[model samples]
Structures are given as structure tokens and as C-alpha cells.
Target chain A: MSDTTPAVEAGRLDTEALEQVLAAPAARFRHDYLEVRGLRVEFDGFVAVDGVDLTVTQGDLRFLIGPNGAGKTTVVDALTGLVAAAGSAQFGGVDLLGRPSHRIARSGVGRTFQTASVFDELTVLQNLDIAAGARRGPLTLLRRRRSVPPEVEAALETVGLAHVRDLPAGVLAHGQKQWLEIGMLLVQDARLLLLDEPVAGMSQAEREETGLLLQRIGEQRTVVVVEHDMEFLRAFASSVTVLHQGKVLAEGTVAQVQADPRVVEVYLGTGAHGRGSRTAATSTEVE
Target chain B: MSAARPGSARTAVARPDWWRREGVRLWGGIALAVVLLVGVAPAVLSDFRLNLLAKFLCLAMVAVGIGLAWGRGGMLVLGQGVFFGLGGYLMAMHMKLSDAGPGGVPDFMLLYGDGVVPGWWEPLRSPVVTVLAILLLPAGLAAVLGLAVFRRRVRGAYFAILSQALAAAFAILLVGQQKVTGGTNGLNGFRSFFGYDLADPVNKRMLYYIAAGVLVVMVVVVRLLMRSRYGELLVAVRDQENRVRFLGYDPAVVKVVAYAVAAAFAAVGGALFAPVAGIISPADVGVVPSIALLVGVAIGGRATLLGPVLGSIAVSWAETSLSEQFPSFWTYFQGALFIGVVAFLPNGLASLGGALRRRRARGSAVPEVGPASDVRPAAGSAGGVPADPPAGAPDVTTDTVDTAGRHA
Candidate 1:
């Protein structure tokens, strides 16, 4: 776990260095930034995600921490075009709100489910190969893959699953499956990654490795992780957004949000509202 | 496990030993099939039996498409009969036109209609257009339909129902157009096929060879597809469509390609069926025939490359033999066989060898302790099976369990 410290520090420094060096194209970078405004999602009469505004730039290891039903996942869903969203989400100069999910993915956005959804019947290498084949034409897809691409090989090494590359993903351990899903995102060259509870069921060692992996990746890409584990968030998050009941409750560095009075109140309260019971249930589940 | 290390080595340079062995097994399996289909069956069987075998080969062609679509892509395509019928009708029309001579109307039109061919049937007089239409029309229609349905994320039983309805509607449409489609009787008595006399046994043998040759080519094509990157993507789309979508692929497009390919294969099968069976009718391309095709695929092992082909041939042979002996029992027996395969062997008969091997491993070896034991058998037996079985039979079993649990 301590070894992750140097990588995290280096990641921070690299981000600052990139900020200064790429400042000339700062305007261009801002155009490609993920900027969401007044995003709302409704399921029947129930508002799952209320008017939320978020701005995630490159090199952002942004953590979205909230209690259950706080609409953290819903916000991610809206951005990924999984749900119908109102208002505007501009990513890479394209409005992501009404576009289909695949189109959003085509515009360099990728996501992973909490349960680590992977092609279980396919081997790990094949999974990565398929992910790397997004821009491949019909003819290329039809032809047999004569060689494993360098990017996929690199991803396998980075994810520490090179030994099991030939095994079907179905047989992968839970932690390895989550890592494989992340590896898939890497091979896709996704500019924006929205990971939902990636370390939910991982062991401590796996969680530490994941934090280091996220830090390493967050150096160049924008990543928003919807998380429940407070310790993991503290270890890796550069900045945090706290949501309560479909609205943004607070936003700042982990220390800053931890210090925020309203955030503390939400975390501790067992008030008259139904949120008390829900928060209590969820908080008990969070280690 | 000794071979496992090399199999895990980088695919480009190391060229895993398992891969080489798999190639040998694949081509070897095809070679065996070619021998049986082209050489042995024709040589051994009588002329009538050879013709019957030719018809079975035509039907097996449809199964190849089904294997790609339903087996690999996880689409329950229940309307292949529509495409099969399209091909059969197209070929039949061409044959009828040829028999009537250039620019002359078919004899059926003279008898059933007002002695004039409809303009739609006129283009089929040109062999070139007929052939092209036989190949392209069904595929085009399937692509269009696939785009419409898959884009909207319709799948599972709903897709099956929609496809089945298409077959029903097509049959109804043909029945209603009595003058054009020859009512329920449909078109029959194709005396010639591409200038070859159908009555001549030599020409019939040539037709059998043609069907046999086409079936082999199709199997090889499907085998290539199953080994390609597209095959991996198709399986991925089947198991986790939403996940594939996030990987920057339109799952709908992946699905459409497979669906269209399946349609094309079924169409070709139907095209060959017309001349071989000496008829094209609604009965041959309706809800029942479509289900029959599916049953054969299910029984043979839809996922395995040759499973569908073998299953189709076996089922057709059984139908011919059993129906002759006991007509009423064959249908019930087919239903029972489908149920038995789905219940006892969800991966189809192709997976039976793998299953038996696994059982023997479990029984002979010390009782396997945990999840660690699960992967060893799969890795060790990579080139062991002749069907080139897909990975993880246990995974599919669990998938079935999940589906059942969800419904329950």
C-alpha cells in the first residue's frame, strides 16, 4: 500500500507539469473537457437525478461519494447516455445528452458496471482484443487476428493478468475480473472513464493495486469513480463530490469535504426523513 | 499444464502449440466431413438415397447460419424459413421460366392465371438476376429488420416472437396470393435446373455434388467467421451487449452482420432445396420448418462449428426414416429430442464429449476441491475436442441457471 504513495505523488506532479506545458492549448483542452449543466433524469414520476452540474477535466481523479439513492450512479448513467437526460453535456464538442450510448462511447467515453460485466465466454486476451477493435472495419474483423497488438499486451502486463491471458474471463477471480474490466477500458483508449463501484467486492490488496492503477491512469485521462468506500476514496481521490438526494451537497478535496459541516451532518444524522434509514443501511454496508 | 504455458505466451510470435493443433483439428475435421459428404455418402448410398442426402445437405446449410446467429450471437432467429422460402421460390421461378423457354410464361401461370407472367416474376427469367436475388434479397431484408429491432435493444423472447411472426405473415401472404404462389400447393415439377435435365440421374448426381460442394464451402466460410475477431465480438455481444456498447461498438451493427449472414445462408439452402426437393411451397418455408431447423441446431450443438450441420443432417435422416415407419411419432420424438438436449445438454451434442471428459476427470481424480480446479480441464483439453468447442461450458450452464432464476 505504501508503494502507491510515490506513484500518486508522481501522478500529481505530472498533472501539474502537463497543466503548465499544455497551457497554450488550454482553450482546446477545455473544449474537450466533460462539462455537464442542469442534467436531470426522471424514472416515471420519481426524479432519480436532479439538476446537477459537473466539470471534469483531463487529469481529474474525481471521486463521487454519496449514500444509496443519492443519484451518483444515475448521474454517471446520464453522462454515458444509458438514461434519457435533459440539459446539456458537452464532451469533445459533442452534446452527449440525447445521443445513443454507443455514439457516446465512440466519442471517447467508456464505463464499467459495478458487477464487472465482461465477456465471460471469451478469454482475457480476446476481451481486450475486442475492446481494441472499435474502429476496425468489417473486413478486418472478419480476418483472423494474426498478432496481439502492443497496446493489449501492455494492458495485460499493467493489469497483472498476463499469466491468465489465455483463460476465459468467466473463470477469473472477482478482483481479477474487475481489473480485466479496467484493462478493457485502457485498450479502448477511452479519454473519459466512469467506473461504478470498481472496488466494491475487492480484497484489501486488490483495492490497493486498483488505487495505484487508477492513479497511474488518472495522470492522462479524466476519471470519475462512483464509490462507497471512504478509505479508498481518501487514498486516491484528488477531489470529491458529495451528493444527497439527487443534488450536489458539497465538492472539494477529500479533506475539505470531510471538514464540510453539511457533509458531516448527512453522514451522521438519523433524522425524521426516510433518508436516515437508507443512509444508516448503506453506511453499515460500507467498510 | 505444460502446454498451457505456451498457449498463454504472446499470440503473434510464439504461435501457441494449441493454436497449431487447433488448426490441424479444424482442417482435419473439415477433411473428414468432406470425405463423408462428397466421397463416401454418394458412393455407398443408392441414387434415391443420394438425392435424399442432397436435400439434407441443403437443410444443413440453413443450420450453419443458425449456428452463427443463434449459437454464437445469442439471437433466437425463428424466421429463417422466410429467407429459405425466398431462396427456394427464387430458384424455383428461374427453373420454371427456363423450362417455359426464353421470354415465355411458366406453365403454372397459364393454368392458374391469365397466361401472363407478372412483371415481378419477369426479372427472374434472367439467370443472373435470379441468382443475385437469391443471394442478396434475404440478407438485405434481414439486415433491415435487424437494424430496426436491435437498434431499439429488443432481444430474447421478444426477438424470437417477432421473427416467428414474420414467417407466419410470409406464409399467409403467399397463401393469399394464390395466382402468383400457386396457393397452398406452391410451385412444383422443376424439369430443368440451369439447362440440366432434372430427370437425368447424371444431372441429379451433379445436383447432389453441387449441394454437397456448396455446403462444404459454407461450412468453411462459417468456420473462418467463427475463428475471426468478429466471432469474438459476436459472442461478447451475446453475453454482455451493454458492455460491448461501452467499448465504442454499436452492438446493433454486430448483431445485424450475423443476422444478415445467417439469412444469406438460409436463403442459399432454400435455393438448393427447390431443385433437390423438386418443389417450393409455403409448407417448406413456414413456422413449422423454421422451428424444425432450430431443433436440429439445438440438438447438434449450436455453438460448435459442425454441430448444427451434423444435427441437421441427422434430424433430416431420422425424419425420413422414422416418418416412413411411423409418421405420427416422428414429430413427438423431435420435440422430445429438443427437450432432452436443452435440458440435459444445453450446449448441444457437440459439448457431450467435453462433458463426458469432465465427468471422468471428476470421477477418476481425487475430488476437486475448489474454483482452482475449474480452469485446468479447459486449458488441458484445448485441442482435445474435434468440434473446436468454445470455452467455458460451466459458464453457459450458470447462464441458463441465471435466466431460469430471473423468470422464477
Candidate 2:
């Protein structure tokens, strides 16, 4: 998980991936911080996200949790340039506001949709290849792919999709598809990952696996998860930001957020408290 | 077991399996086509039939471009006639000027207007300038048009209609400028082509060979583009435009490149059509011919490399043979064929092989992801289901379930 880890297999001394990483210093692991100040998004006359401010630095596995229509996704959308917002979202010394989505992505910020949007017609390897090809020149893109980049190969192994590397993405299982999307971000060299409901339709076991995968990925970058599943957040979140009615309600550790009165009121008073599964513990009361 | 997989990645990379299979097939198909067009057709068919075949090859050139733009890039180009007409008219103008000799006015100008060649027509007096204009004009126009349209996010049927409207407008413009464009009569009656006597059978055969060579080269170029990383990106944009953007790609740029390439190909086809068909007119470069070009591509299978070319030639041949006896029925038949292909076989005739293989695999209880035909998803599956839908109702979740089941 650290930057010093060898890019290739442990015993392999020289490989294409190792050589590639060595030749390209920019490919080395580097952390990027995301700073949002007074972020607001309006759909016509209705404000979807209003005056939300947050900061996520290196190794912060911060969770953005809120009830339905509480503007959890709208904040991520504002940061990723999916929606026109009036605020400053600074990432890696570049302002994400007023820029196109692809330009925002080029500035080391990547995001995944609630529904995984991997190309269904391409193979798993081809999906990663496209993500890895952002820096390639036009003439280079015209030539046939002679070899797989080390980062793509590593991402394949990380997502547990090396076995199905050549299979068309459409035939992948639901959990596998989500992992493929994350793996794509990995090869894309995204420093800030804003995942929106990554495990929305996953089974219990798949949820745990995705949580562990996020922890491993968060070790060298800034990670933000927008989740409605409180149980999953409580289990894996190092810190949490609670959004209520288009604004940040609370920001702290899992226990601290649970103890905050304003977050409890927003979750319960909004009549959306019993929307998800609740355990016997009082911490589950947030659900 | 671990050791066994160590070099597997390298093995996969070095094998070039796709190139070995599809590449070999492509080259072999081209060689066979060259043999038939160069050797067999000339020996067996009469000069008149050979000329008609050459004309179809020129039309097939436009289909090649459509295969790239509509088939791979999902642009739904319904205005290729504009590019075709641009190339054809440019070449026709050059031939007319050469026949009139330097400074002498063409017969059309003498008959229709004051005896003076238009300033625009003067530049094409040089064969070099004419060739360059034929090559660049259509592509340049397409590039500008594509950038403006795609950047504003105009696509789907809106893009199609815009292209069709351009074709319609182009035909009207030609008609309005009768003094220059030859109006309804169009441009014809050339005694020679590039200094060779058109009246000579030897020169006519030479033109056929030239058209055949150009078509073969076009197929090769398209094949190379299709196999490159750009090809994958083009299809990626087609299927998921938003996803490609999030991956740090400008979908507009990708679309513009494909559209411009298609335009260039159509232009080349048009230039050839003028010499082979011996005419360049508003009727040939209009809305109906544009649709006719698409019908061939749709029937051939837009997604495949050779599908459009072969399908184009087949459809043109079919029209030549069937339309002569039942001229009225040909239009209805073409329409019906296009409708059936879009409805039942959205991937066109090329996907028939894949569908048959899928069925046989299902029967044998084997999951076969056949590499032979690397066909993308059904073109119809890009957005809507294209079949039956409950009117004005939201079937979002239901549709999701249905698609997931089908994929499984």
C-alpha cells in the first residue's frame, strides 16, 4: 500500500511495469488534498447542495452520509464537475469549479457513479487501458497496444479481476463491475477518489470486500465515500461528515458523529431513520 | 502453477491474437477482392458491366466512411451526400475547365450565363489544385461542422437530422446556382479524363483499376484505424459518452475525428464517381442517395470492418439487377430491408454469425465468448430498447432487471 512497494511481483527484478514506473517519475504515488469552500449547486430555482464546506487530505477515508435527497451526491457532483456549482473546489492546486468534467479528471480527481459506468462492450483489460491512456499522444493511440502498462496489470490483480481480464465487461458480476470501475480509477492515477454509493446493490460479503479494498486504496491517496448505508460507514469510516438539507451537519469520528445531537435530529426528525437496517446497538440509531 | 502464469502476461501481449485472426482475414479478403476486380472482372464482364461495378466501388467508398462514423463512433451521419457532392463537383469542375482549355469558358457557361468562368472555378484549372480541393474541402467542412455540433452536445437523431438537412440544402444550393453547378442537368459530357480519352475502352479499364486500387487502400486504412487504441476509444465514446469524459477524454474531439475521416472518404468516393459514372449532379448528391448509402451499411453490419464495403457492393448490385425489372418495388424493398435489419438485427448482417454462435453455444451448454467476431453491443442497445414499451411509463427498475437477466 505504501509508495515504496515494488510495482511488479515481489521476486521479479525487471519487468515492463517496473521499468515503466521507473522511467516515468510522475507515475509515482503522490497524495492530493481536496478543499471545498461554500460549495452550492442549484437546479433551476431549487438549491440541491447549499454552502457545504469540507476538507479531505492524504489518507482520510472520510464518509459523506445523509438521508435521501439530503445532497450527499450533489456535493460529489459539484466537486467532479457533473453539475454547475458556485463555489471553490481546489484539488492539487487547481480550481475544479467552472472547468469541464474531463479537465477536472485530468487534475487528478476521479469519481464513480451510483450505477457503475464501465464500457460494457470492451474487455476488462481494455477498460483499464482506456483509463491509462489519458496521457498518451494521438500518434501513440493510433498504434496497436504492444503491451499492458504495469499500473493496469497491478490494478487488475488488486481488483481480483485478473482471472476475467479478457472477458467483456458486460458479463461481469455486479460486485466485479464495481471493482472494475475502481480499478479504472487506479490506472487513471487519480489522487482523489469520490465514490458515490459504490456498494448500493451489493450483498453483505461484497460490502466487506469493497470496504477493505477502499482502506487499501486510501493508504496512498485521499478517499471520499458517499453512502446511505450507515452500517457500512460505521464499520470502515475513519471520519464522517454528516450532510442535512444541503449543508454539513457534523464532522468527526464514527463515535463522535453518532453522539452529535444535530445529526440524530436530521436522521430521525426527517422521518427517514428506519430506511436502512438497524442493529441493537445505540450507534445504529443514526440509521 | 505460479511459475506457469509468470510469463502468461508477456505471452498474451506478444501473441497479437486479434491481429493474427482478424488481420489475416482482412488482408486475405482484400487480396481476393483485388484478384476479382483486377483480373476476373476485366476478363469475363463486358466493358459496360465493368464500368457499373467501378461506379459501385466508388459508392462503397462512402459506405466505408459511414462504417467508421456511424458504425463505430455512433454519429448516425445522414449527410454524407454533402461531402460526396463537394468532391464530385470539384473534380467535375476541373475536368470541365481542362476540356475548355486555359481561359476558355465551358459549354454550360456559354449556354447558361455570360461567357466567363467563375473565379472559384478558375483555381481548379490546375489538376494539382483540383486534387487538393477534392481531398481537403469535405474533411475541412466536416471537421468544422462536427466540432460545432458535438461540442454543443447535439447527438442522436438531432445530429442525424442536421446532417440530412445539410444534404438537402446542398442540393438546393446546386440547383439555385445553375450557371456554375449545371443545375438540374448537372455536369457531364466529358471527352477525356486527366488527358486520357474517355472514348477509349483501354482508358476506361484503367479508370476501373484506379477505383479498385483506391477502394482497397481505403479498406486497409479503415482496418488499421479499427484495430488501434483509437478504435476502442471511439466505441467507448459511442457506448458511454459521459464515462469517456470522466476518464479524461473529450468525446467531442473523438467524434469529430471520426466524422472528418468519414467525410474525407466520402469525398474520395465522390471524386471517383464523377469519372466512372460520367456525371456529377444534384440528384446524385442529395438526401435520397445519402439514405441509400446508409441502407447498404445497415444491411451489411455497420460494426464490422468489411461489412459496409461488401454490403454496399451487394446492395448496389442488387439494385442494378432487381431495379431494372421492378424499378418501383426497389424503393419499398430497400426501406423494408433497412427496417427489418434495424428492428431484428441491429448489428446488421455481420452479427448473424455471432448470434448463431451464441445460440449454438447455449445449446451445447458452453459459454462461448467468440473472439472471431469482436462485435460490440447491439447498436440499438445504446439507449432505448427500440421494441415494445409501455407508453409514457417509467420502467427504470424493470428495464434494469430485464437487461441484467439478458446479460446473465
Best by DockQ: 1
TM-scores for every predicted model: 0.86, 0.86
Q: Where does model 2 exceed 4 Å of error?
A: A1-31, A268-287, B1-20, B364-408
Q: Write the per-residue lDDT of candidate 2 for residues A126-211, one digit (tens) a residue.
A: 99999999888999989989998888888787777777788788777677788889889878988889998888777677788789
DockQ of each: 0.71, 0.63
lDDT per model vs. reference: 0.83, 0.83
Query: For residues B128-235, what per-residue lDDT tens digits would candidate 1 score against the true structure?
Result: 999999999999999999999999999999999999999999999888887888878888989999999999999999999999889999999988998999989999
Q: Write the per-residue lDDT of candidate 1 for residues A13-123, one digit (tens) a residue.
A: 122322332234334344457888998999998998888889888888999977889999999899988999898998777789888888889888989998989988899
> In model 1, how large is the Cα lDDT of residue B299?
97
Q: What's the fnat for candidate 2, on a 0 to 1 scale?
A: 0.82
> Measured with DockQ on alpha carbons, how good is candidate 2?
0.63
TM-score of 2: 0.86
True contacts kept of each: 0.92, 0.82
